[model samples]
Target: MWAARLAAPCLLLAAATAPLDARAAEESEAQPPAAEAPAWSGSLAAYLNLPRGNEAYVTGIAIANRGALHLEARSNYEGMDAYSFFVGYNLGVGEAVRLDFTPILGFVTGSTHSVVGGFEATLTGRYADAYIEFEYVPDAQPSGYAYAWSELAFRPVDWFRIGLAAQRTRVHDNGRNLQRGVFAQVKGKHVSGAVYWFNPASHEQVTVISVAISF
Candidate 1:
């Protein structure tokens, strides 16, 4: 009788574990664990500022992003010796014609100190894209000031772009408040280089060389 009793308990224990293992496998298949979050993509760009009758300088900018979150920094972008940091959210809209905009808020430091507000927007079509950016500085000397930069680009091939560029700034003063020019860019897998010639007229010509890397 003791032998049969021991065998009975062992059989019952095996029966219990068999259902437990089956239930665990079923639950695991029904609800899977979540996946890891997506990674951020970003870029850094440098511009070599060369203008007629002015000292040469370099402008640096960096951006880090994850999804809709945007972060950016600039040195010597707003003015000479100036630095700024910005936070913005990327908003995208449209299908046939698309628009992407980032309304950025930042603080200026180093040269001209102030609170800055602006937006970077791009309108895209079949073969061309139009981009515009503006920043307002309420604490500028004398009064509030606004600066703008714009580009209209046409792409005949995937890796090359020809564009018309315009800007209003005090960053480089060669006796002109507004500068307009032509630019061409050649892009590789992760790097791009562009040359801009502003005020193409011989009198107050300005040239800018841009090199950028994306990750």
Candidate 2:
């Protein structure tokens, strides 16, 4: 009789805990996994203008997770005409599209002393990139102006990309000008470089080369 009573209580205890153990396991399985942490990255770039005989340098840093927040600064060593700082955010629309919005503030050396506001938007995908930008300045030389640029590129190998690029600029007094050209880019693990050559229908030719390093 004593052994029978001991076995009965042991069976009762196991039966009571079995449901609790199963419920815990089910909850664990249903819970989602933790998200990965964000990463920080930065890049430095230099651009050389062949026609203008000027050089511009730019540096930027960003933190990326679901989206990226970045700050960039640019300066022209030959002159201060293109000195500016930009703050921007990059948001992923879906698997292949990313959008960026940035605000620009800069001075036009020997021209407007006041800081002006400018806006830039960029859309990028696997094979193409496009951007529209404009700046507001009361005393700008070309008057109110804006520009749009687009490029479609294909990667034939791991490190080389070839593309066709087009650019349009609209100025108040100068009218609209369009330029089209071909571009090539080569990329390495930590460095990349690109070159562009465009000729306006009735204007001077423009050439630009840029190199960038990432860390």
Candidate 3:
């Protein structure tokens, strides 16, 4: 009798909490589905980003290669002085289709900062001399939730190329915006340079210039 009396109030408490849990679950289910990834042709490439802020000036290097398997790793300086590690994998390239997986770890300079993770995915196709890609940013989070980015690139000349891309990012739970950018790259036997322009979140225009050497 004593044990039964002790369990009765606990059961009532659980019954009271159950509806709150069910309501939260329903809300999550009502959200939209994840976006579909873009399409592209498979190629191996290396990228280096030289940023002017954060570390006063920091360089980010990335290498992405394709075979039967693929691996990638990159690091960047965020905002003022924070750094993060992003690692990912690509699969099915040797076959007719491809799949990708990415996991990230982040660190900040201050004690109040929290580490977060984000990832992206893309599918690619080839048509004539042009390649197209559709990409989805799973969750941009501390980097900002730039949800989707799609690109089309064409090689008119062997060492010259042009690309057009569009991106959509969610700034807050109920707010989002779009960005469009154009890029051109010219490669010579030992030197290369690129120019790109885009509109940022604050509705300001920004441009990037990059010069690099080929090994």
For each candidate, give its TM-score against the true structure: 0.84, 0.59, 0.43
Stronger candidate by TM-score (2 vs 3): 2
For model 1, what is the alpha-carbon lDDT of residue 97? 91
Point out the higher-scoring one by TM-score: 1 or 2.
1
- TM-score, structure 3 vs. true: 0.43
Clashing pairs in 1: none
Tens-digit lDDT track of model 1 for 1-215: 99999999999999999999999999999997898786898899999989999999999989998888999999997899999999999999998799999999999999889999999999988788899989998987667788888999998887888989998888877767799999999999999999999999768888999999999
Model 3, position 66, has a per-residue lDDT of 41
Error of 1 at 26 (Å): 6.9
lDDT score at residue 101, model 1, on the 0-100 scale: 98
Which candidate leads in TM-score?
Answer: 1
Tens digits of per-residue lDDT, candidate 3, 1-215, equal 99999999999999999999999999999988887664322322333322222112333433343432333332332322333333344443323334444433333333114444444444433321222322233233344332344555676776876887654533212232655677788888767776655454443444455565543
- Best-to-worst order by TM-score is 1, 2, 3
Model 1 error, position 75 (Å): 0.8
| Local distance difference test values of all predictions, in order | 0.91, 0.60, 0.46
| Model 3: residues with Cα > 4 Å off, grouped in runs | 1-59, 64-78, 94-150, 167-178, 188-192, 200-203, 211-215
Root-mean-square deviation (CA) per prediction:
3.4, 5.8, 20.6
